[model samples]
Target: MGLVERTSSRCAGRAKAFKSPGAWHAAGFLAEADLSANAIERARRAAPAYIDLTSSNPTHQGLIFPVEMLRAAAEPYWFARRYEPDARGLLAAREAISRYYSGRTPALLVPPDQIVITASTSEAYGLLFTLLADPGDNFLAPNVAYPLFEHLAAAHHVTLRSYQLDESCGWQIDEATLLRAADARTRGVLIVSPHNPTGMIVQQPIAALERLGLPVICDEVFAEFTYRAPHTPPLAALHPALPVFTLNGISKMFALPDLKLGWIAMNVPAASAFGARLEILNDIYLGANSLTQAMLPALFEHGLAFTAAMRQRIRASLDAALAVLKGCPALQVRPPDGGYYLFPRVMCQDDEEALVLKLLERGVLVHPGFFYGCEDGTHIMISCLSAPEVLVRGLELIVETLTT
Candidate 1:
């Protein structure tokens, strides 16, 4: 039978779980019971505009890139464009990624042949899921992570086992929990340095990861936004013996998400064993477009100053938000090491959904902590990736609402 026929046959018995005539793999995501999402929609439709404290998109947050610079970068590609396809993406783009990594603090020297390009980080996750796990096999991912993994795992027909990140210990990985989450079927471990929503960088998990003897998938999309640490080291640089797949992109690095380019930089051993297979998988789709690949070199060369300025703006916003939130007696917040989010514990008896809804009624919107797998307490996620004045005002409203 053909691939489609085989997939249809596999999903034949699972029709009841699906809302439509779609693959059984995506049945769980067909519908979801999210009270906070519903409340946000209703609140937006009502009177009195709301302040969005959970805004993270750089484009929407008033961080504009230089149009002339972007134009200049793409202008050359328009005139000199030729359709040359490589299974691993454009050679020049991969070389540019290698050069960018070489400029990091620890300076990881990645070879162009070891890198595989994808359209976006989301697509990179999908590709990695295919590369690492079979239908029934699983990968270990951190708890309190962005929800993207769950969706990606579902689409790929794999399971994601959760490992704990101890909030009391600055959200560091609990070594014991991590080991316990692994089993014979475990294919790899996913690590998000400078974690989303909480902003905790992976400081000391290399030794523990070595014990597991599994490949590491490090997501470093927010690597450049470090606030507390002197600099965030590439996990690949820290561990030479282990097979590390470092994922990053221009989306967060240069706020160019629309351009659609992300990549996986494989360590030496990983490339030696699995590079051929990954190249085959990437060749089937060749998902990344040619225009962005041509512009990547220029983006890295001219975009550093812009990214540095953007980081300073985010730091100022974070500082302002922390200062205002500190005055609230009913909330307890710890400063994050990196990234643009603040996860603060609500020192109240209100339920997570109720608290989010209450804040929404008061005209400010913040994500409930449960959205990011926070189960220990009632927490709310606040993004400082907004305009300085807007972030401060939104935080002030959160304080007033909780205190009253």
Candidate 2:
């Protein structure tokens, strides 16, 4: 067999053995940063260490929260007394979201009907997936964006294809590339605002997707954590006629992921047929973890302040990471638009796996860019919110390894 065929044939057997797309064969897995998983697991086996630079998790790294405040947010919900909010969500929680969005985009109110509460955005995506695309239909997405959608798509049994996001333009969407990526089989286009890892946002790429007459699934979980632009309204506001499913949750927004609260808001103002289907899907799932939904009103009013504080801390962390990158000649970090991580190319002798493995040995853990669907593996991602001191030290060790 030829080299390419031989490589594929060889890798195919190994690929089938992995649980789901993991670092090994990377076949069936979903979106996860196994860096910590790799570190903690391998550390027990080996115990070489330094600091971890790869984590976006709020709790483990300690983002500095008011424990009492978080406790109080869930307190009222505990008194539940058997009150469920129409399986849609409580009016009080919805109104708080409405008020927040209204302030963010005063020109319009997203009409709380547009929002359906879920236990998490993952559920929101699943709802949208079930509502629009059938099993095996293809979804077009950015070539270099978050990997979580891949896992979700796999679970939903939807095929995913990619269009390029121009790396040179601060990761802007390429309208032509998107057009080329979609066909009749394509059910939807998914976009992550201030995308994960790369941290860039697709500010001006939807016009093409709209032309195709396909629905758009916008994951705005990181919508509130922007750096360059003022918060943009959910895509529903831009093209009211287009069928759009906007997903967001408290996981990243408020840094209260432990709360297990999330939501899917359907914005198909122009397509009532599509809206009806989505509503039914929500009904099928009912509501996720009632107590978490119960905590929403309190979270909106009180926990939000903690989120604002976390954003400030994230900015500081981003600046520190950028500053460190300046000194590391072998590394180049692309400025992210609004997420909590930076994806940069690490100077590697071959692939980043060695560097990643080396970093783990040193106690500093991080994810290789290959984990996020980059065709090439020169990239490594570092969480922008890894505590200030730890991030600095981690960067120092990473730079040290690259140069030496």
Candidate 3:
């Protein structure tokens, strides 16, 4: 008691000197952020009955699941309480993923040894960032794609250089723009097929990726949800000569976001070298859970019906929303090539942020263009994954708000 009291008494005098506690180097990114978007705040406080055009989650959009099949798949974890851990995930789960790819439209034959599992695609991105780049290195990413890569790069102390996806050319990658943006410090390239918000698949000739000789990370989470364009082959499968890491997950693939399972399929012949280092990194974190890994094989084998049903709903909602938006002359609706989003450009002088707030005030919510690095004029992104009736009502509200 005497010793503890003396230590507390000495430290209490110096406690007044503590002003800024967030001294961690990695957390500096959070401190520099400008999160003063009133649109987001208003949307958060909107009434519970407000129509959400921004609903990206499939589980809440009224889709049936094979409950018994999922329950049966998870039963093994209870009986076989084996706590065996592998950095690359369970052998059976890896084999199941390999088989799932090998049976793809054109067949992408991936070896189990070349696969690394993670809790989510977000974690998979962290692993790839660590594997490919040093702190000062940069990666080239599509300018009009999802804003997530920016945050991920910041967290790892890596820079993300913007390469334009020309909207005039159907969101195709402008190779000249990419070359201009990249420098010697560039370590890799990220290509998101069925790009978020833009909805353009990377269908352009990418021989330049092999020429640049940097590793390519492709995100094909929305590959199967294609509607306007034909399903492009997996980037890793198409460019086997290059070091390609393809990321996909149960979240979008099986509409099981709650179950948290994702994978990195490395397609380089020299993957063994990368695999060894990756195993050590994964072992340090060991983020993948055993129950989900145990259930993957069954999910892959029996979950296609659920996926098909979800895709059907997405198409139906998309078609209905597009039909309604077409009648609104104040907007230009470019039907998404794929994915469950409809990113229509709102033709008005109003700032996109103001428009979003106005929409929120009218009991509807949508994202502004600049939120995804789009510097162009007013564009609001709406998701087609919502229930059809809700999507139609949201589209009507948008039309009414903008036309007035």
Q: Quick one: best TM-score, which candidate? A: 1
How far is 121's C-alpha from truth in model 3 (Å)?
0.4
Ranking by lDDT: 1, 3, 2
- The CA lDDT of each predicted structure is 0.83, 0.70, 0.79
Error of 1 at 146 (Å): 1.0
Name the lDDT value of residue 191 in candidate 1.
Answer: 94
Candidate 1's C-alpha runs over 4 A off are 1-48
Worst 10 residues of 1 by lDDT: 2-11
State how far residue 63 of model 2 sits from its true place (Å). 2.1
Q: TM-score for each prediction?
A: 0.91, 0.85, 0.90
**How do the residues 99-144 of candidate 1 rate in per-residue lDDT, one tens digit apiece?**
9889998899899999999998889888888998888788999878
TM-score of 3: 0.90
The residue pairs that clash in candidate 3, if any, are: none
State the lDDT of candidate 3 residue by residue for 237-265, as single tens digits. 76878788889999998888889999999
Please give me the total number of clashing residue pairs in predicted model 2.
9
Q: lDDT score, residue 105, model 1? A: 82
